[model samples]
Target: MRQYWVAPVGPFHTADGTAYATSITLTDVSPAPQITLPANMLEIGSEIELEASGFFSNTATPTLLLGFYLGGVAGVALAASTAVTTTTAAVAWPFQLRYRGVVRSIGAAGSIVGQGRLYLPTSLVASTTRFIPETAALRTVAIDTTVAKTVTVGAQWGTSSASNTLTCQDLSVRLVT
Candidate 1:
């Protein structure tokens, strides 16, 4: 190959005076966290958040929420009594979500509900960003295990946190990790 033209995105020659075209172009190369929250389990006053490549990225507080639901009844949960915490840039945050004043499951086969935001973290992206969503659909935003370890989402939204609408896209929420 003499050279490669990745459209207007790329075009270059190899050190050997020859080059090849890129097989593909990848974006949003951020880490994605694998959650391991169990369902129908009573609040144990313990919480955790984890992060890895291709999991959880650019998550926002008050945007990403975790809850355990049973049938139509859902109980608001905190990462250890914490409701909201700040998410930095490509980094992470650790905090506890409180569930003291939340309801417990009154049904079977409960599921953990979560939310994803499209906002940028103030700590990392402090340049005052527009916070616009690339897609009008759901965003892949959530808390990272690094900065926010524990937190409560129920109380943060208010007393009727259960009534809050839990929406997200490209999200895999389940009882098992």
Candidate 2:
């Protein structure tokens, strides 16, 4: 049997066009753009899909790091992207990311295997958006499926600057089985 659940919360985003500034440490792009998965909602073969889009601008070619977390910003780490150096400076570039995770087990020691890709622009040209695949060899992480889990995405800049800012415009989560 198969089932699906569209998240009831959002398509969430930052409020009032507020953009999150990057620091040397990772931080949530938008605290409000998170989804909570109810306890026992996942089983073997169950899958989760997360889609997000945002715009970023930098004054310097800083190294950017992105991560997915199972709790809040400081919670259990699910996956992290390899450091990507910004190709351009002072240009507002738009990016999109999609992540998929499948439950491999269900329990306090449950696990999920996942992967994702980022569509990042190298320039203002439409065709310049490059597909940056997650190069992690193994993204299997232990999770507690018996309790509710909040998922969020975060980012950091290797070199912090006031001009190095990012704003998440949209985020959606879906459940499938």
Candidate 3:
């Protein structure tokens, strides 16, 4: 059994080319795309960002749902009240993850099997709701790496059952670093 997952896009390099990120291709067709990387499990002194895109068949609208811990984490299936549409989108939550080895087993686990990390260990559930009406590909997630230890990032397009999901190459190379 080979470890492999199918994504529309790629796990590319970041701006500094140091860290990496990935995205799920958004199209007019497909299942609703949903992704999450729990909270409170990142190694100290780590800088990272997550990006998600849903392939919309038609340009009706996009919805944003976030869930995690620390300061700005929310639920996965975000409130119906909160929805958005764009080419690309990103969310920044200050967090630290604890499970390094576990989270990096997505590919090996195969497809349709969700994977995650813990950014907030002890208590607390999530944070706020900051939505962008429009999102572009290139520059999605932005974090300083000083505030958060770990974070969960994901998105869903109003149109799509399966939006392709990918991560930065650096991250793909090593799900947990």
Candidate 4:
């Protein structure tokens, strides 16, 4: 069996006095319905995007691990937030992780903000962007159909402050093969 999944498309405009509609076809082999793989297993030479968002706030900030895992025992780790600290305040954190390669090249980024002391004892603000270099030797581990795997994208609140609120807005995996 095969399936063609078309995602939502709209708001496409032609402002140059010329407009055109284009379509691309994607093919996929049918797999178990209960465990749906957006495009399928993480094949070699494939690119995948893992997106996730969440909200967090704390009165007595604590350490947090917001990341995504792509395997079981041996796998790739796409971290959106690593050892992020929550202060005595409320803030929303959203993140995205990307993996592309024959051997996988992984990267991650997100919105980070805080009031007063956070992450560090001193005030600091920096962007978080990481990418693995693409090379001939690059390789990404695949999900073994026979064994269990842990491919999850989410945030883990280590401890609670006065009001520690952790909410996951969205989590999705898209394949760009």
Q: Each prediction's TM-score against the native?
A: 0.19, 0.84, 0.22, 0.47
Identify the leading candidate in terms of TM-score: 2
- The numbered model that scores best in lDDT is 2
**For model 1, how does the per-residue alpha-carbon lDDT over 1-177 read when each residue is reduced to its tens digit?**
444221110112112211111111111111122223334332322222211111122323333323321111122222211233434232432212111112222123222222222232345334222221223231222222222121112212222222222212121222211
Kindly report which residue stretches of model 4 are placed more than 4 angstroms away from their true locations once superposed.
1-40, 71-76, 91-150
Task: Summarize candidate 3's per-residue lDDT along 1-177 as a digit string, tens digits.
Answer: 645332322224242111112233221111122222334333333222333322112222334322222122332211111343333332322322121112211221211112233231111334233332122221123222223222233333344433323221111212324
Q: What is the lDDT of residue 151 in candidate 2?
A: 79
Q: In model 1, which range of ten residues has the least summed lDDT?
A: 17-26
Residue 108, model 3: lDDT of 19
Question: lDDT per model, in order?
Answer: 0.23, 0.72, 0.26, 0.35
Q: Which ten residues in a row have the lowest lDDT in candidate 4?
A: 23-32
Off by over 4 Å in 2: 1-18, 31-33, 126-136
lDDT of 1 at 72: 12
**Rank list by lDDT:** 2, 4, 3, 1
RMSD of each: 19.8, 2.8, 16.6, 15.2
What is the C-alpha lDDT profile of model 4 across 1-177, one tens digit per residue?
Answer: 745342321222222111111211111111111112322343434444544443444556666554445441124443333455544454444333443223232222111111111122212232345333122232323343333344444344556333554544444455544
